[model samples]
Target chain A: MSGDPILSVDRLMMRFGGIVAVNELSFSAERRKITALIGPNGAGKTTVFNCITGFYRPSGGAIRLSHDDGRSIQLERLNDFRISKQAKVARTFQNIRLFPGMTALENLMVAQHNALMRASGLTVLGLLGLPSWREAEKRAIDLARAWLDRVGLLDRADDAAGNLPYGDQRRLEIARAMCTEPALLCLDEPAAGLNARESGGLNELLLSIRNEQGTSILLIEHDMSVVMEISDHVVVMDYGVKIAEGTPQAVRDDPKVIAAYLGADEEEAIAVMESGT
Target chain B: MSATSARPSHAAQPSGSAFIVKKALISALVALVLFSLMIGVRTEAGPQGGLIYWTRFGDLAALVGTVFGGSIIVELLRQWWGPVDKDSIVPKPVQSAISFAGRWLAPALLVFAVLVPVIFYDQRYILDLSILVLTYVMLGWGLNVVVGLAGLLDLGYVAFYAVGAYSYALLATNFGLSFWVCLPLAGILAAFWGVLLGFPVLRLRGDYLAIVTLAFGEIIRLVIINWQSLTGGPNGVSGIPRPTMFGIPLDNSDNGLAARLGIEFSPTHRLVFLFYLILAMALLTNWVTIRLRRLPIGRAWEALREDEVACRALGINTTTTKLTAFATGAMFGGFAGAFFATRQGFISPESFTFQESALVLAIVVLGGMGSQLGVALSALAMIGGFELFRGFDQYRMLVFGIAMVLLMIWRPRGLIGHRAPTVYLERNQSISSDLVKEGHG
Candidate 1:
């Protein structure tokens, strides 16, 4: 992959009137790198993903994606489909957003639908059930199976998405997002409630996505192992403002990062968290 | 692309799973089919293949078998080719024929239905009521859009019905417009009120929307009542021009249809003509409604009903979707209303009330939301069944009330309910969870 950041955010701000959820946060995620945005709780990392994915319009500033094909898209101006189509930005939610009633394979296939443009034709009404929007549904299943296999979830692909175990659901969420073949894949709190084994599975999956697929990753994760072990670049945030950015080792050494975790009210808790960091 | 992925080796296959499985399934399906066939069989031998050839069982089996069989085909496709994965296995043109017949059945069914009265009934009065049942079927199909597919729950549907009747009555009487011209005019004017009613409730949803639409229907009727000079007050504008076939009026004049056609003019022929007219309008309503449901706008509607957030996220403007539902539903209502005016040659505000909306809503709900067949069944139940109870007028409304209550308790989601949605149907690989999984989709 080219050595350019797949996503460039310059002074992004998201506000709900008086409360600024994410403030003037600027960062660049390099190509094919698992970049982590870690912060104490309520650090507005999810907000950043929402802005980039077109779930919410940013109040100010810009988020841009530099595609491998030499096209630069300003995601802030684009609607959700445009963000998904033009920028090729894909994301997972903090809580999984599967079409719960749908089966696991169907969920992934829906994500791959934008790639199905080759199949839209008049004589193909029989394929309305076929969802011929994409030629790669079989390929999509093959891909979904591979991803599920990577996360050890190939067996549960037939189950309703809602019926999957929590860990499998998280992995399935990641798999669903990846089905879009996004240039920049953003994860929202992927490691939140996973057990150690599941978290390890997530870490390896994220790394494989980066290495095997050459996809640039911008992940919002709280688990230290996932963030520090897999991430190439780490950005630390506190209450919506960026406090530190660098290699995991360097950001782990920053004093401001320590102070930010020492935080507004939970200075003692921050001291404890920072001491571990 | 990968057929091997579909059938994995070493999975536990059911024991004795050979031709035994085939025999078992066929026998079960035969049993089920026979069980269904038994319902349509008449023990009383009533009228030798007449209207009494219906059993609640046949209708029930026809509906249930249709649903399960449709899903079975989907399941087979999923098994054979890995997965259907998309919405259509065929193209739009292939479905057009089925959809065309589905839509045009109103006219065909209407023609066949009109023949029923002339053949079975000796009384002309019963023919008039049959005409009325056919009219409501068209009306239910119209209102089904707003309340059924779109999930808007409009209670004031009858207001549009009244508006069309009045528009035709007033325009025909004052402006002297012919039946053919006023027919379309009535629909347009009714649609205008539909839009007017739609605007105020743009932001309202669910029960609030229901209450507002109910009130709006009442408001239209009240306006018709209080607007003395325009709607001819509560006494209603009468002496409306009769709808003639081409230039030939069905009047008993020397220059009327009898003289022109060189056939003996009977009032039954006139009723027959009106029956045909109502049938045409009804067929047009069914045809247009079905086609609309398959369009981009219609798909957007189903999407909106599934999850409003997902729909908006897909960039569907909910406002436009809701308005279109109102406008389309009202357009059909207007068609029915215009026909009503022509049939009666009169109009009144009394016809457009809260009761009318409730009846229309009842039809949509009972017939099954978003299913064309469901709505037709609902209309058939409400109009046809109610007409059947005419000799027991004292207990007609009571029977309707009891039926609705029992129906609500038994099948609260409405008879057929909304479809299981294509996305789920296309991918659900479960062979056993079919029965319990009915309402969740």
Candidate 2:
């Protein structure tokens, strides 16, 4: 909370044709903190994630990332890969997008593609079987193994990513994102389909990611347990407008947040309905 | 077929004896009628005047009987064996055997390829055919990089082939360069073209990408045909120099391999030398591709193939991955093309046609994409099979069609569908093709 915000969004706007998916929303995610962006379906939470990750160009606003290397990057100006590679921001899709044909270990290795490509001299040295390439490859495999161990998928390292169980695939996706060594990890929905046990594991994983790895996290999730449990800051949106933003307890008790979640206060709603009749 | 299989006939009971008999009878009846109409009756003008109907009853009966008898035997065997349950996992012993073969098969094939000309030193035709098959094998491996690993459906791979051939033809003929010098140059020129072609088609995916590439191939061929001054039009460039060993050719002259080695020169020596040259090039292509697959860029190519969006999200540049795949694949195609020009001592647009692209693609698909040994084996089967049909030219296409169909029905994943993981922590297991995407272009 004390560190300058890792991500600062100001007046973000996303328009598709005549409709505004996200409008005039502003928020900040602190360094090494878990920030949750939650709302009902189609509330543009995912849109904000996409815009911040450079998948979609924002209609208006600046997405500024304060990098660990003391460089502040405007992600809106970069392409999707440059955002990840340069700004050091990584993301995962809501629907699991693991490479179906590649084994679990390979998915992680591929995240370190830029580093390894440089080491291999862009295939020239690698093709010659040089020792430099071998060292780079060894380091890549070691990092992949470390992340695999962190996600508790080291035993299934050889199995195809697509073949892993649903929860395991989710964990693998996180492991893959982590392997990129991102300064900020954005997960669309990490616990969307997980059961209680899996979500518990994910909570523990996210906590360690913030505490041990010290990577800032921004997640779009509908799973309340995950949001309430690990999130240091909570930002709620309704119809692309920020309704409340604070600590989890403060946001939980906010009247506007309650109305957004439960759909209008009972007394006000009843009075309006009576007046209409 | 599914409708027929789904039908609940009493004949389809587990015993299936009656089912076999019914299938045989139906097949025989269909064959008998078709053959009778096609071959039984004929009309000829009589020598005296009028036309007379002539019935070749003995020939008709023999043809009908053969069809009936063959179909019945086939049906009986099919019933006895039962329909193959391809969905079931491969048997443990069979799987292990296949893995063993997968490991040793390439080296064995390499050794066999090296020794073939020596064993059949007198038979020039066999050596020629071996070289042809190896050429296709090389071309197939090239296409495998684009279509298999990168999952870019390049239907115009032949354009690079033509580029390579013409590069060598132009360089060797105009600049008086050696085969070895033009060889790498040809590859570079083709890869340059590949990237040029790749740039415009970057945004396209799936069938659209395929169509654009197909158009690109046709364009290259058309350019070669129309640019008469450079390419000699359809007449082709001739007397393209054959590759030499070091600085010497493979003839009986003072500078030839035979003269240098103090041996009597026969035509076999030249043939044998060419075979070894192609063998070395093919092995080099294989070695480079295999080595690249272990590199990060190689993995990125595969990752792009799997899911481009996810690959981009993971920080791997999709454009570069795709371009590298195209350029690498095209470079190999160029090498093969240069070899083709040297081998034939000719260059023509007819040599680089859509059919060449299709044939190379068939080799990759039939071998299973992303599988190196698969491409080699498929090249052998396809090229060797076509050569075997030299006497029965009319039926070659039909046989190829049937073979392709049967192979698809038997193994939809193509032969050797198992993909060995590039980087594995402990067990290096083969991934089943069932889990692979039917890749977008």
Q: What is the DockQ for all candidates, taken in turn?
A: 0.09, 0.66
Please give me the DockQ of candidate 2 compared with the native complex. Answer: 0.66
Candidate 2 docks at the CAPRI level of medium
Local distance difference test, per candidate? 0.72, 0.88
* TM-score per candidate, chains pooled: 0.66, 0.90
How many clashes does the backbone of model 1 have? 26
lDDT of 1 by residue, B326-371 (tens): 8888988988888888888777877777877778778877876666
lDDT of 1 by residue, A1-277 (tens): 2357888899999999899999999999998888999898888988888888888999999988888888888889987556765677777778766555445765565565444333333214323534553344355567767766777766777666656778888888788777778888888889989999889878888888899999999988878888889999999988898878999999887777766665445776576556656
Q: On a 0 to 100 scale, what is the lDDT of residue B203 in model 1? A: 76
lDDT of 1: 0.72
i-RMS of candidate 2: 1.3
Q: lDDT, candidate 1, residue A96?
A: 68
> Docking category for candidate 1?
incorrect
| Residues A1-277, model 2: lDDT tens digits | 3557999998999999999999999999999999999988899999999999889999999999998778998988997799889988999999999998899999999999988989999788888889998998898999999999999999999988888899999999999999889999999999999999999999999999999999999999899899999999999998998877889999888767676678876887665445534
